[model samples]
Target: MKNRNQSKKPKFIVISEQIISKIISGELLPGEKVPSENELIHNFQVSNTTARKSLQEIESRGYAQRIKGKGTFVLNKTEDHHLVRTLGSIDATRRGFDEGLKVEGFKPKTIVLEKTVLDHGVSAEISGKSYIIEGPVLKVHQLRYADEMLLKDETKYISLKLCPKINMLSTDLSYFKVYEDKYQLKISDIKQNLSAIILPPDDPTNNFEYESALPVFVLDSVVLSRKDAVLELEKSLYRGDKYKFAIIAHPEYNGN
Candidate 1:
């Protein structure tokens, strides 16, 4: 049995997590100044020491650094080999880079390789549920480039029942943006699996025509709507040499 009277997380820890979430979501880009200690104190209703501790935690964790008299600034930790990518829960659903690649001073281009509508009879099993393909299912295949460098290949299967007009929308834009902006749909959750594989030369997915021995990271994902209905299935392949991934876990919380 779980304890009914567990202690809550410390105020400083909670404040640190709030800022970290923004960092992970790319809401706070590298070199941007984080909130000052006074801001944290006022916003979180904590003491000066608590706020200072929170900022210290951020710096110690390598998310930011404090320069005397200039306040703290976000660091581009992704440049380090170990922290190239982060995939986790967030309020916004974004595909490749969070915010935009341009924030990093690179002009990223998203190209639609293919777009088509699939008829019924296509089905897949996820979490023990059989999801049958209904009429006019929208399928999109895309390739992304940053500064003219190949980055990733992505394929998406969107249920027409959820977004019937998806086929009419521009495939060059993010699907989450289209769902929210055009259809006014809110994505509530995501289920994903990550694995690495070396593609054979004859494999159809070797669309980019990479050398046969190159390894890639395959990400399988399902997007869910507010009512827990499946909205989209996505398979994204990322170049392993150019990217790495990290997982950030939050403490398990019990309803009070």
Candidate 2:
């Protein structure tokens, strides 16, 4: 016979996810911080020990960091933070580099019902089943430069339903950091797509076409979670002359 009282309860991750999502939904703000240990204990109906464990884990993962005098501090706010690109480039991870950001624009445009269509003049690069993920998608575009050299231009689209509150987001705020805390949506894996492109006179930004013969590098990455849902579609283009992407991959064995 089954014990009626012994119900398999949900994990702390589930509770933490709900609370964090509310935070990302702008129910919580940057540098605003979260509840104290005691408040979490009462709110989640969990023990003090369990609540502490949840907060500690989230803080450890760079979603938030504990300060000595102050309580836990959220990391999303852009206060001259040095972050890396994580692409297959050594330059991507270089820290302490002089960087600056320009707020191109941040307005809520009515996203069309369907997905993306690459307007590149050349051949259709991305193949079948890789065009776009299924769901509400919101796109964020930015141009990144390494010091005086124009490095790359990036366009990232995240699930809209999961991030409806982004219209109020600032340059200091980070979407991935917020999602990790709120949805417990870990970035379990990422797949990358790379291609080369030629510059033209009327391209976006349309500046500094080298007199030499060379092409730019375009990268498209899709991030997925353990739940098998698509997190974000990131497409970026880089100046090949200024940056070089270096990676070492080895094949294990042939059919032995």
TM-score for every candidate vs. truth? 0.65, 0.46
In model 1, what is the error at residue 109, expressed in angstroms?
1.3
**lDDT of all predictions:** 0.73, 0.52
Candidate 1 lDDT over 105-138, as tens digits, reads 3557878888999886355555556655566678
Q: Which candidate should be chosen as best, given lDDT against the real structure?
A: 1
Q: Which stretches of model 2 miss by more than 4 angstroms? A: 1-128, 172-174, 202-214, 248-256
- Per-residue lDDT tens digits of candidate 2, residues 84-197? 233533222111112112211111122122234222211112434454454545556655553344456666777655555554455334556556766677766556667787
Give the poorly placed runs of model 1, Cα more than 4 Å off.
1-83, 95-99, 125-133, 254-256
Q: For residue 220, give model 2's deviation from the true position in Å.
A: 0.8
Query: Candidate 2 local accuracy as lDDT?
Result: 0.52
Inter-residue clash pairs, candidate 2: 20-182, 21-182, 78-172
